[model samples]
Target chain A: MKISHAICLSAALATAPGLAFAQDFEAALKARQGQFRIMALNLGVLGGMAKGEVAYDAALAELAAENLETISELHQAPLWPEGSDNMAIDGTRALPSIWDDRADFLAKWDAFGKAAEQLEEVADEGQSALGPAVGAVGKACGACHDAHRQPSS
Target chain B: MTGGQRLSSDDLSAAAGDGDAAAAEQVFWAAGCASCHAAPEAEGDALLTLAGGQRFPSDFGTFVAPNISTDQQVGIGGWSFEDFATALRNGVSPQGRHYYPAFPYPSYAHMTDADIADLWAFMRTLPADQTPSAGHELSFPFSIRRSVAVWKWMNLDDEFVLGAADTESLARGRYLVEALSHCAECHTPRNAFGGLVKGRWMGGAPNPSGKGSIPNITPGALDWSATDIAYYLGTGFTPDYDSAGGHMARVVQNLARLPDGDRQAIAAYLKALPPVAPLDGGG
Candidate 1:
């Protein structure tokens, strides 16, 4: 995961300047990827319930849905600061489009948040509603990926 | 070897009067044209506007879909039914130029004359857009439209790639998946030059969209029962409870819009396909 350790060491020896910014960018990229992974895991739990792969436990669905809403609505603007794209940071699929089209990217993020909100609202609806609600959230995630996220390598 | 027949404009124009708009609408949905031709983020009635300029980045280059709306000058409005059939069946434009396979005519070549006529009539009912087309952005050799003729010679068989359909569901599934749905365009691996590799049909390949590989649907790879497969098409949920994400989510959206019979037929056909190990890193 440490893609630029050699470059970072060379830069540190060349100049004291820009090292902290580079480190911060690396941390931000890792943090967002980690955030997305956690969201996927949490969503998988709700998805299992929705698909009837796992027993429909209302309590567990609520917990998973709430966790998804929390992660989606969290204020993590710093995690997407410019220069954290795949071009700047290897091992990342965050395309330059995210920074280039900031408004669209943020709007897509908000779309996910709205979908998560809907899921949270309906998590208590048991079997029938949970399936469709989870689907809505999945659609929102895909919409964001389609417009903003680069395809995974 | 049901390569499409060329419908005379007279025949199609007459049939146009008797075309079943309801059935034509089903063909439109099954063909998934809006998946590429419609503007990004288009919804509801906007899906009917065929002002195609969507850019699909590919290994060859970016292929910009042309406007197929009924605008006489920019779209296909002035095209005779024969002209349209020629493009769909033979990958030749009305001007007799070779069309790049990006239009998926290789699969569409199997369409019956009636289906094509129905589609033409249905498209005519949509709003015409005069929007100019943004053509393909390819480099040197690929940019040469004449070269597509050679590529077609090597790749375009225009036959049903699958085995004989023994059952009614299999027959219906064959039409829906092979002729109309064109599942092979992505799910099947292609050779170095981007022609579908028949030997590895539905064995999956590197995602043309550049995501992780598309999943293999061959029996060896996907062991889901027909019922599970149908359910996934309808609801977007995998057997393991994970929801489909990425481009598949859009495919599911379209599949969900289809009738239950269509979904079931797709599943039955998929399950009936010959088993093969994935060619690429397909799951």
Candidate 2:
């Protein structure tokens, strides 16, 4: 009876780690991927307006605005889940320093979230605000990257 | 993780002793410049060949690296020997414009004059196909290089050479680390104007390379020994399972080809230099 119980305990312990592993890094990657997709699609909507390639559709514009807000809200959270090792999810490249300096890394994310939120508010206002919205969004991209991104070759 | 991570600083005891131009070229090639610059076709995450196009995504936005090949119409082909030396020594271009230190001129500046000559000769020998190197797409104050000069004047001294009190080996290391290599430009943090924030030397910078952070590499890396540091420079791996990824692989490749004596000198120089907190942008 003792042996059977020990085996059961050991087996249970072995499976425990597997359960935690179920939290796929892919989920994080796909979320960022989704951000890029939606951001690009929204840009397409804006570009269409600029080029007069498509007639201004209020409904389409509304969708783009919604996407902008969603992305902005998402940006407020950490690009990488706390304790993550993946670089791509963070919308950055590979450099061991990201993991090496935790405080600075987190601070960069915090700054980015603030800028993203501001841009989202502007972007959600509609086509009339595209100029400022683009600038705000661009600024957010720059703010996160300047301090945290790796060097150019 | 620590055991295999760093390469032995002394392992390259067999490095070719001849520091001639040929040897210099050999080091340059071994350093993996071709991996990003010389490829006939651009690939991977890199944006350009030697005509640099690698985009460094930073808090400021994505800054693309410039092509530095000897493309006469488009690259450094027009550069004279002095032009090259000035760029390396001062982190300025032939046109006297301040380079963003993205060229690794800080570390590259530490290379021996002879090695610089060799590199120049080799670069001059590359295909001179002009691919227009564009201006940095920076915002406000950063878009201008003159302002960069003001920043340069504040952050860097006239020239931070090795002190006479340092040993010959230490001097060599300083020369390589500061001038030829300019490792500090990135490995060292900056003040608001982009100068090497005083009191904070090479505790590792926020890796301006558009990738991962470059970590605080003082004795701060508790697991690393002096020998371990040397080995990692020689090999791409560190003592802890971390290998030299990103642009640092090129650094290891360069060190691997350098004379064993020179590599040790570099390590000693690093050890002796005063330590400082690079990015003290307190959270």
Best candidate according to DockQ: 1
Alpha carbon lDDT at A140, candidate 2? 40
| Deviation (Å) of A72 in candidate 2 | 44
Model 2: which docking level applies? Answer: incorrect
| CA shift of B202, model 2, Å | 1.0
What is the DockQ of the complex in model 1? 0.24
A1-153 per-residue lDDT for model 1 (tens digits): 355776675676477544334465767878887888788788778876765667888888889999999998788688888677766655677778888988888887898899889999999887778877877776676666656665542
Total clashes for model 2? 52
- List model 2 lDDT by residue over B11-59, tens digit each: 2222223246566665465334554454332432231247765566555
Classified by CAPRI criteria, candidate 1 counts as acceptable
DockQ, all models: 0.24, 0.02
Q: How many residue pairs clash in each candidate?
A: 0, 52
Model 1 chain B: which ten-residue window has the lowest total lDDT?
A: B1-10
CA error at residue B170 for candidate 1, angstroms: 3.9
Give per-model CA RMSD: 4.2, 22.1
Q: In candidate 1, what are the lDDT values of residues B85-182, reduced to their tens digit? A: 78877888777788889899998888777888788778888889988999799877899988887788888785687778898988889998999888
Q: lDDT values of the candidates?
A: 0.78, 0.54
